[model samples]
Structures are given as C-alpha cells and as structure tokens.
Target: MRLRNCLYHFAPYGFHATWHHLATTHHIPGRIESNPSSLVRALDELETARALMLPRAVAFAAQRRLQKREGRRVPAALHPWDSWGCHDIAYCPDPQKHPAEPLPVVVDRVLGACAAGTDRAGRCLVCGREDWDLWRVCQNCGVASGGRGAHH
Candidate 1:
C-alpha cells in the first residue's frame, strides 16, 4: 500500500530498453506482485537521477532572472538537438560499455560531441561503430531510434 502511495505521485517513464535497464540495475523485483517494495527501488533511482541536477537547475533559473533584469531578455541558446525537456538517452547492453554516469551527463557528453562538430566525417553518433541504421537502435551504444540519433 505504501508503494502505491509513492507511485501515485509519479508517472511511468514509459517503455523502452533503458527503462528495463533501470529496473534491473535498481534491483526492482522481476515480479512486483511478489515484492511490491522493490518498486520503490526503481522510483528511488529516478528520484536520485533527478535530484542530482536540482541545484544546477535552480542556479540556471536564478541566472535567467538576473539576465532579465539586465535587459538581456534572450536566453542562452541550446544545442539544436536539445529541446526544453527530457530526452531519450541510450543504454548499452554490454556492461563494460554501459554508461556508469548519470543519464543527463551521458546525454551531454554524447550529444555535445555532435554539437561541437567532429573529425569523424562519415561516422554516426556512437563513433567507431559505423553501421547507423536510422530509426533503429544503435548497433554500438543501443540508443533507440529517437533524439540525436534520429538526425545523425
């Protein structure tokens, strides 16, 4: 019943391999009916990921307000691939290549490379693993058919 209360406050992050990775990594039960509290582990992972950035977001908000006062009404430009909210970050199946950092940081590092222009002229977003089947998972990083890979 307590798990129900916790979940009622949040929406499911949606279905994807990344979601499954979260479930497994966070130790969420393979079957929730047998152990409902394991669901909280999943929620806790989401919360921790989200929490990692709250301070930085708060700082950005304050900086934006200060700029508004200075007649700098324009906001800092975002990278072309960056929308105003969450993006679909990828999960690598191979544990060794999997992103151990926070998802947001991983997104920044991966997409940031693309935004900066790269030496790899023909290669796709994941770099050396070149068979980029657009609208399909990355053969290298397991990124789904969305976000930056959609364009690369």
Candidate 2:
C-alpha cells in the first residue's frame, strides 16, 4: 500500500522495479497485494523516463560495455548523487604550503592514464587492435572516440 501510494506520485517502471526488488529481496508482503494494473503503470512510467534519455543512455551503455571489453574503468557517469554536498572551489595548488604529495592522487593520475589507453602507446580504447592498418571503426561506439555524454 505504501508503494502503491508512492507509485501514484511517479512514473510506473521505477515504481514496479523498485517494488519488485523490495518484495522479492526484502520480502515486503504488500507487493503481493499490488495489482497488475499498478505494474503496467510502473512500466509505462519507465518508458517515459527511458525516452527522455534514450540517446544519452544508449551512448553511456555502449561506452561502458566497450570499456569493459578493453579492461578499462569506464569514466564514471555523473549522476545527481555525484555532487550532492560539494562546495565548488578553485584548485589552488601551492607546493610550499603542502609539502607531501598525496599518494592516492598520484595513483589516480596513473590509473587515469591506463584507462585512456595512453600508457601502452596509443592502444585503442574500444578494440585492442594496435596499428592503423588494422583499424576499422573504433571498437568503442561509432561516436567519435571521446564523445562520452554529449547528449546529456
């Protein structure tokens, strides 16, 4: 009932998926009481949400899959939660003020290089093919090599 009550407030797919997960995993008994109409409504809501972001979502999904194939970390997708409470501050790096180089920052830089396929001498991010002669379309999405979230 709580879920049904909440479902009325939003599109239905999010509600249904959320409800199904809650019911099956958390064993919420009220989900069983929820009717098929509610499930259909939830899916309709999902379709609308999907429509709003179809182009961007498809690109992000493709890039992520391509990154996985090449054994690289997909650059993190910036969801709303990524910047919840952060103050926007300018970077002021003073070598004199902070003597100790942060190890994690250094490691992150190294990891970023690896993710971009730069360390191994121009390795393609999508497919593992080396030289241009072997090149067809980028193993990544058909979008330009760097276009990650253009639609968003």
Cα RMSD (angstroms) for every candidate in the order listed = 6.9, 19.7
Candidate 2 residue 121 Cα shift, in angstroms, is: 38
lDDT for every model? 0.46, 0.34
Backbone atom clashes (below 3 Å) for every candidate: 0, 3
Candidate 2: Cα lDDT at 18: 33
- Candidate 2, residues 41-95: lDDT per residue as tens digits? 5444434433443344456567768899999976764332112111100011221
Q: Give a tens-digit lDDT track for model 1, residues 14-113.
A: 1343455455666666576876666767666656644543454455567667888999875543322223223333434333344444444554455445
TM-score of each: 0.47, 0.25
Candidate 1: stretches off by over 4 Å:
1-18, 27-31, 79-139, 142-152
Evaluated with TM-score, which candidate comes out highest? Answer: 1
- In model 1, what is the error at residue 135, expressed in angstroms? 15
Q: Which candidate wins on lDDT? A: 1
